[model samples]
Target: MKVNVDLRLKDIPGQLVAALEPISKYDGNIRGVVHHHDDRVGGRITVNVIFEVRSEQSLDKILSTWKEGEVDIAKIDAFFETYPIQYLLVGSITSKELESITKGLEAMENVASIEIRYTGTANSSSRAALVTGKASKKETLTTLESFFKQRADKHNYMLIRGLD
Candidate 1:
Protein backbone atom coordinates (compact mmCIF):
# COMPACT_ATOMS: atom_id res chain seq x y z
CA MET A 1 0.00 0.00 0.00
CA LYS A 2 1.07 3.55 -0.73
CA VAL A 3 0.61 5.91 2.18
CA ASN A 4 0.82 9.68 2.40
CA VAL A 5 1.17 11.06 5.88
CA ASP A 6 1.44 14.65 7.07
CA LEU A 7 3.38 15.12 10.28
CA ARG A 8 4.18 18.17 12.35
CA LEU A 9 7.57 17.96 14.00
CA LYS A 10 9.51 20.28 16.24
CA ASP A 11 11.68 22.76 14.35
CA ILE A 12 14.82 21.52 16.02
CA PRO A 13 17.91 19.77 14.79
CA GLY A 14 17.53 15.99 14.26
CA GLN A 15 13.71 16.10 14.52
CA LEU A 16 13.32 15.34 10.82
CA VAL A 17 15.64 12.36 10.98
CA ALA A 18 13.98 11.17 14.14
CA ALA A 19 10.56 11.35 12.50
CA LEU A 20 11.72 9.40 9.42
CA GLU A 21 13.54 6.60 11.23
CA PRO A 22 10.40 4.64 12.19
CA ILE A 23 9.20 4.41 8.59
CA SER A 24 12.45 2.83 7.44
CA LYS A 25 12.59 0.70 10.52
CA TYR A 26 9.18 -0.70 9.66
CA ASP A 27 10.34 -1.46 6.10
CA GLY A 28 8.54 1.38 4.32
CA ASN A 29 10.10 2.50 1.06
CA ILE A 30 10.10 6.28 1.23
CA ARG A 31 9.04 7.79 -2.09
CA GLY A 32 9.07 11.55 -1.36
CA VAL A 33 9.27 14.05 1.46
CA VAL A 34 8.28 17.71 1.44
CA HIS A 35 9.32 19.74 4.46
CA HIS A 36 7.48 23.01 5.06
CA HIS A 37 10.20 24.66 7.08
CA ASP A 38 9.14 28.25 6.37
CA ASP A 39 5.59 27.55 7.49
CA ARG A 40 6.30 26.62 11.07
CA VAL A 41 3.58 27.01 13.66
CA GLY A 42 4.29 27.03 17.40
CA GLY A 43 7.87 25.89 16.84
CA ARG A 44 6.82 22.98 14.65
CA ILE A 45 7.11 22.43 10.90
CA THR A 46 4.92 20.31 8.67
CA VAL A 47 6.36 17.41 6.70
CA ASN A 48 4.51 15.49 3.99
CA VAL A 49 5.88 11.99 3.52
CA ILE A 50 4.86 9.53 0.83
CA PHE A 51 5.96 5.92 1.15
CA GLU A 52 5.00 2.41 0.15
CA VAL A 53 4.63 -0.33 2.74
CA ARG A 54 4.17 -4.05 2.34
CA SER A 55 1.06 -4.29 4.48
CA GLU A 56 -1.28 -2.44 6.80
CA GLN A 57 0.49 -3.96 9.78
CA SER A 58 3.74 -2.31 8.81
CA LEU A 59 1.97 1.01 8.52
CA ASP A 60 0.40 0.57 11.92
CA LYS A 61 3.80 -0.15 13.46
CA ILE A 62 5.22 3.02 11.93
CA LEU A 63 2.32 5.07 13.21
CA SER A 64 2.57 3.54 16.66
CA THR A 65 6.26 4.35 16.88
CA TRP A 66 5.59 7.96 15.86
CA LYS A 67 2.88 8.31 18.47
CA GLU A 68 5.13 6.88 21.16
CA GLY A 69 7.79 9.39 20.21
CA GLU A 70 5.30 12.30 20.43
CA VAL A 71 4.97 12.94 16.71
CA ASP A 72 1.93 14.97 15.67
CA ILE A 73 0.23 13.47 12.66
CA ALA A 74 -2.11 15.76 10.70
CA LYS A 75 -3.45 13.46 7.99
CA ILE A 76 -3.05 10.08 6.33
CA ASP A 77 -4.26 8.55 3.06
CA ALA A 78 -3.72 5.01 1.84
CA PHE A 79 -3.86 3.78 -1.74
CA PHE A 80 -3.94 0.17 -2.94
CA GLU A 81 -1.95 0.28 -6.20
CA THR A 82 -4.49 2.71 -7.62
CA TYR A 83 -5.20 3.01 -11.35
CA PRO A 84 -7.64 5.49 -12.87
CA ILE A 85 -10.23 5.03 -15.65
CA GLN A 86 -12.51 7.57 -17.29
CA TYR A 87 -15.02 7.25 -20.13
CA LEU A 88 -17.42 9.59 -21.88
CA LEU A 89 -20.61 7.79 -22.82
CA VAL A 90 -22.70 9.49 -25.49
CA GLY A 91 -26.17 8.17 -26.31
CA SER A 92 -29.80 8.16 -25.22
CA ILE A 93 -29.06 7.21 -21.62
CA THR A 94 -31.76 7.07 -18.98
CA SER A 95 -31.60 7.42 -15.19
CA LYS A 96 -32.47 3.78 -14.57
CA GLU A 97 -29.82 2.60 -16.98
CA LEU A 98 -27.24 4.93 -15.41
CA GLU A 99 -28.09 3.56 -11.97
CA SER A 100 -27.73 0.02 -13.23
CA ILE A 101 -24.37 0.81 -14.81
CA THR A 102 -23.11 2.38 -11.63
CA LYS A 103 -24.26 -0.58 -9.59
CA GLY A 104 -22.63 -3.03 -11.97
CA LEU A 105 -19.25 -1.32 -11.75
CA GLU A 106 -19.51 -1.07 -7.96
CA ALA A 107 -20.14 -4.79 -7.77
CA MET A 108 -16.84 -5.65 -9.40
CA GLU A 109 -13.96 -6.77 -7.20
CA ASN A 110 -10.89 -4.51 -6.86
CA VAL A 111 -12.85 -1.43 -7.95
CA ALA A 112 -12.22 1.09 -5.20
CA SER A 113 -14.67 3.77 -6.29
CA ILE A 114 -16.82 4.80 -9.26
CA GLU A 115 -18.49 8.06 -10.20
CA ILE A 116 -20.65 9.15 -13.14
CA ARG A 117 -21.85 12.59 -14.14
CA TYR A 118 -24.68 12.89 -16.66
CA THR A 119 -25.47 15.77 -18.99
CA GLY A 120 -28.41 15.97 -21.41
CA THR A 121 -29.53 18.42 -24.12
CA ALA A 122 -33.05 19.81 -24.31
CA ASN A 123 -33.70 18.95 -27.98
CA SER A 124 -31.77 15.83 -28.86
CA SER A 125 -31.69 12.09 -28.18
CA SER A 126 -27.96 12.28 -27.49
CA ARG A 127 -26.87 12.38 -23.81
CA ALA A 128 -23.46 12.30 -22.18
CA ALA A 129 -22.18 10.65 -19.06
CA LEU A 130 -18.69 11.10 -17.65
CA VAL A 131 -17.73 7.88 -15.93
CA THR A 132 -14.69 7.85 -13.68
CA GLY A 133 -13.32 5.09 -11.47
CA LYS A 134 -10.28 3.93 -9.56
CA ALA A 135 -9.17 0.32 -9.34
CA SER A 136 -6.49 -1.38 -7.29
CA LYS A 137 -4.70 -2.91 -10.25
CA LYS A 138 -4.10 -2.14 -13.94
CA GLU A 139 -5.40 -5.54 -15.00
CA THR A 140 -8.62 -5.00 -13.04
CA LEU A 141 -9.10 -1.60 -14.71
CA THR A 142 -8.46 -3.11 -18.13
CA THR A 143 -11.10 -5.74 -17.46
CA LEU A 144 -13.52 -3.03 -16.39
CA GLU A 145 -12.85 -0.98 -19.54
CA SER A 146 -13.49 -4.04 -21.72
CA PHE A 147 -16.78 -4.67 -19.93
CA PHE A 148 -17.80 -1.05 -20.41
CA LYS A 149 -16.92 -1.18 -24.09
CA GLN A 150 -19.11 -4.23 -24.57
CA ARG A 151 -22.01 -2.45 -22.86
CA ALA A 152 -21.51 0.63 -25.00
CA ASP A 153 -21.53 -1.45 -28.19
CA LYS A 154 -24.62 -3.34 -27.16
CA HIS A 155 -26.49 -0.10 -26.45
CA ASN A 156 -25.24 1.63 -29.64
CA TYR A 157 -23.49 4.34 -27.62
CA MET A 158 -20.23 6.08 -28.48
CA LEU A 159 -17.66 5.53 -25.76
CA ILE A 160 -14.75 7.96 -25.60
CA ARG A 161 -12.08 6.85 -23.21
CA GLY A 162 -9.72 9.21 -21.46
CA LEU A 163 -6.00 8.73 -22.04
CA ASP A 164 -4.39 6.76 -19.23
Candidate 2:
Protein backbone atom coordinates (compact mmCIF):
# COMPACT_ATOMS: atom_id res chain seq x y z
CA MET A 1 0.00 0.00 0.00
CA LYS A 2 1.08 3.56 -0.68
CA VAL A 3 0.49 5.99 2.15
CA ASN A 4 0.86 9.74 2.29
CA VAL A 5 1.50 11.20 5.73
CA ASP A 6 1.00 14.91 6.37
CA LEU A 7 2.98 16.13 9.32
CA ARG A 8 3.39 19.46 11.04
CA LEU A 9 6.61 19.72 12.98
CA LYS A 10 7.93 22.40 15.26
CA ASP A 11 10.60 24.70 13.87
CA ILE A 12 13.23 23.29 16.13
CA PRO A 13 16.50 21.65 15.21
CA GLY A 14 16.16 17.93 14.39
CA GLN A 15 12.33 18.11 14.48
CA LEU A 16 12.05 16.92 10.89
CA VAL A 17 14.40 14.01 11.48
CA ALA A 18 12.56 13.12 14.65
CA ALA A 19 9.27 12.98 12.75
CA LEU A 20 10.70 10.73 10.03
CA GLU A 21 12.43 8.25 12.35
CA PRO A 22 9.15 6.49 13.19
CA ILE A 23 8.54 5.60 9.52
CA SER A 24 11.95 3.96 9.17
CA LYS A 25 11.65 2.28 12.56
CA TYR A 26 8.39 0.66 11.48
CA ASP A 27 9.94 -0.57 8.20
CA GLY A 28 8.06 1.78 5.88
CA ASN A 29 9.83 2.09 2.53
CA ILE A 30 10.12 5.80 1.83
CA ARG A 31 8.98 6.76 -1.66
CA GLY A 32 9.14 10.56 -1.58
CA VAL A 33 9.22 13.48 0.82
CA VAL A 34 8.00 17.04 0.28
CA HIS A 35 9.31 19.28 3.00
CA HIS A 36 7.68 22.70 2.79
CA HIS A 37 9.73 25.06 4.91
CA ASP A 38 8.09 28.14 3.45
CA ASP A 39 4.64 27.13 4.56
CA ARG A 40 4.25 27.30 8.31
CA VAL A 41 1.30 27.23 10.63
CA GLY A 42 1.94 28.39 14.17
CA GLY A 43 5.67 27.88 14.14
CA ARG A 44 5.43 24.47 12.47
CA ILE A 45 6.43 23.35 9.02
CA THR A 46 4.36 21.07 6.80
CA VAL A 47 5.93 17.85 5.58
CA ASN A 48 4.28 15.41 3.24
CA VAL A 49 5.86 11.98 3.19
CA ILE A 50 4.89 9.16 0.89
CA PHE A 51 5.82 5.61 1.87
CA GLU A 52 4.83 2.01 1.34
CA VAL A 53 4.04 -0.49 4.09
CA ARG A 54 3.64 -4.22 3.98
CA SER A 55 0.31 -4.35 5.82
CA GLU A 56 -2.26 -2.48 7.87
CA GLN A 57 -0.54 -3.61 11.04
CA SER A 58 2.68 -1.98 9.93
CA LEU A 59 0.83 1.28 9.29
CA ASP A 60 -0.70 1.15 12.75
CA LYS A 61 2.72 0.62 14.35
CA ILE A 62 4.18 3.54 12.45
CA LEU A 63 1.31 5.83 13.48
CA SER A 64 1.65 4.73 17.11
CA THR A 65 5.35 5.47 16.98
CA TRP A 66 4.61 8.91 15.57
CA LYS A 67 2.33 9.60 18.50
CA GLU A 68 4.98 8.39 20.92
CA GLY A 69 7.52 10.65 19.27
CA GLU A 70 5.13 13.64 19.57
CA VAL A 71 4.88 14.10 15.81
CA ASP A 72 1.76 16.02 14.85
CA ILE A 73 0.00 14.19 12.08
CA ALA A 74 -2.28 16.49 10.08
CA LYS A 75 -3.70 13.89 7.72
CA ILE A 76 -3.03 10.47 6.25
CA ASP A 77 -4.10 9.22 2.84
CA ALA A 78 -3.77 5.59 1.79
CA PHE A 79 -3.96 4.07 -1.66
CA PHE A 80 -4.22 0.47 -2.78
CA GLU A 81 -3.54 -1.01 -6.22
CA THR A 82 -6.39 0.12 -8.45
CA TYR A 83 -7.63 0.31 -12.03
CA PRO A 84 -8.31 3.81 -13.34
CA ILE A 85 -11.39 4.91 -15.27
CA GLN A 86 -12.39 8.26 -16.71
CA TYR A 87 -15.74 9.74 -17.73
CA LEU A 88 -16.70 13.04 -19.36
CA LEU A 89 -20.02 14.56 -18.46
CA VAL A 90 -21.49 17.25 -20.73
CA GLY A 91 -24.64 19.37 -20.52
CA SER A 92 -26.40 21.14 -17.68
CA ILE A 93 -23.96 20.43 -14.84
CA THR A 94 -24.55 22.40 -11.71
CA SER A 95 -22.00 22.51 -8.90
CA LYS A 96 -24.47 20.86 -6.56
CA GLU A 97 -25.10 18.04 -9.01
CA LEU A 98 -21.39 17.53 -9.55
CA GLU A 99 -20.78 17.51 -5.83
CA SER A 100 -23.56 15.02 -5.34
CA ILE A 101 -22.18 12.77 -8.06
CA THR A 102 -18.63 12.93 -6.75
CA LYS A 103 -19.74 12.28 -3.20
CA GLY A 104 -21.89 9.44 -4.32
CA LEU A 105 -19.02 7.85 -6.20
CA GLU A 106 -16.66 8.31 -3.24
CA ALA A 107 -19.17 6.65 -0.93
CA MET A 108 -19.12 3.46 -3.00
CA GLU A 109 -17.27 0.50 -1.45
CA ASN A 110 -14.83 -0.12 -4.30
CA VAL A 111 -13.90 3.46 -5.18
CA ALA A 112 -10.44 4.51 -3.97
CA SER A 113 -10.16 8.09 -5.25
CA ILE A 114 -11.97 10.58 -7.50
CA GLU A 115 -10.78 13.65 -9.38
CA ILE A 116 -13.15 15.99 -11.17
CA ARG A 117 -12.45 18.80 -13.62
CA TYR A 118 -15.24 21.10 -14.68
CA THR A 119 -15.15 23.57 -17.61
CA GLY A 120 -17.80 26.20 -18.36
CA THR A 121 -19.28 29.36 -17.00
CA ALA A 122 -21.23 28.89 -13.80
CA ASN A 123 -24.25 30.60 -15.27
CA SER A 124 -24.28 28.51 -18.46
CA SER A 125 -26.64 25.55 -18.71
CA SER A 126 -24.17 23.66 -20.90
CA ARG A 127 -21.08 22.50 -19.04
CA ALA A 128 -18.51 19.74 -19.09
CA ALA A 129 -16.93 17.80 -16.26
CA LEU A 130 -14.16 15.27 -16.53
CA VAL A 131 -14.17 12.69 -13.77
CA THR A 132 -11.63 10.03 -12.93
CA GLY A 133 -11.90 7.29 -10.35
CA LYS A 134 -9.84 4.34 -9.21
CA ALA A 135 -11.51 1.00 -8.64
CA SER A 136 -10.07 -2.09 -7.07
CA LYS A 137 -12.02 -4.82 -8.88
CA LYS A 138 -13.51 -5.54 -12.30
CA GLU A 139 -17.03 -5.70 -10.89
CA THR A 140 -16.48 -2.34 -9.28
CA LEU A 141 -15.60 -0.84 -12.63
CA THR A 142 -18.89 -2.12 -14.07
CA THR A 143 -20.75 -0.73 -11.07
CA LEU A 144 -19.04 2.62 -11.51
CA GLU A 145 -20.07 2.76 -15.16
CA SER A 146 -23.65 1.95 -14.24
CA PHE A 147 -23.68 4.53 -11.48
CA PHE A 148 -22.40 7.26 -13.79
CA LYS A 149 -24.79 6.26 -16.53
CA GLN A 150 -27.73 6.46 -14.16
CA ARG A 151 -26.65 9.87 -12.92
CA ALA A 152 -26.18 11.20 -16.44
CA ASP A 153 -29.57 9.91 -17.50
CA LYS A 154 -31.31 11.32 -14.48
CA HIS A 155 -29.71 14.74 -14.91
CA ASN A 156 -30.11 14.80 -18.73
CA TYR A 157 -26.38 14.98 -19.27
CA MET A 158 -24.46 13.46 -22.20
CA LEU A 159 -21.88 11.10 -20.79
CA ILE A 160 -18.72 10.51 -22.77
CA ARG A 161 -16.37 7.67 -21.91
CA GLY A 162 -12.66 8.42 -21.87
CA LEU A 163 -11.08 11.85 -22.35
CA ASP A 164 -10.14 13.23 -25.77
Q: Compare the candidates by TM-score and give the number of the best one.
A: 1
Query: Candidate 2: worst 10 consecutive residues by lDDT?
Result: 133-142
Residue-level lDDT tens digits of model 1 in 1-164: 99999999998899989999999999999999999878787888899999999888999999999999999998899987878878898987777668778888978898888888888852336999998978877778788888888888887788898887
| 1-49: candidate 2 lDDT, tens digit per residue | 7899889999889987887787788888999999899989888999999
TM-score against native, each model: 0.56, 0.50
Weakest 10 consecutive residues of candidate 1 by summed lDDT: 116-125
Model 2, residue 1: distance off in Å is: 0.7
Q: After superposition, how far is residue 59 of candidate 1 from its true place, in Å?
A: 4.4
Candidate 2 TM-score over all chains jointly: 0.50
Best by lDDT: 1
Q: On a 0 to 100 scale, what is the lDDT of residue 57 in model 2?
A: 91
Which regions of candidate 1 are displaced past 4 Å?
Answer: 4-28, 32-50, 54-81, 121-124
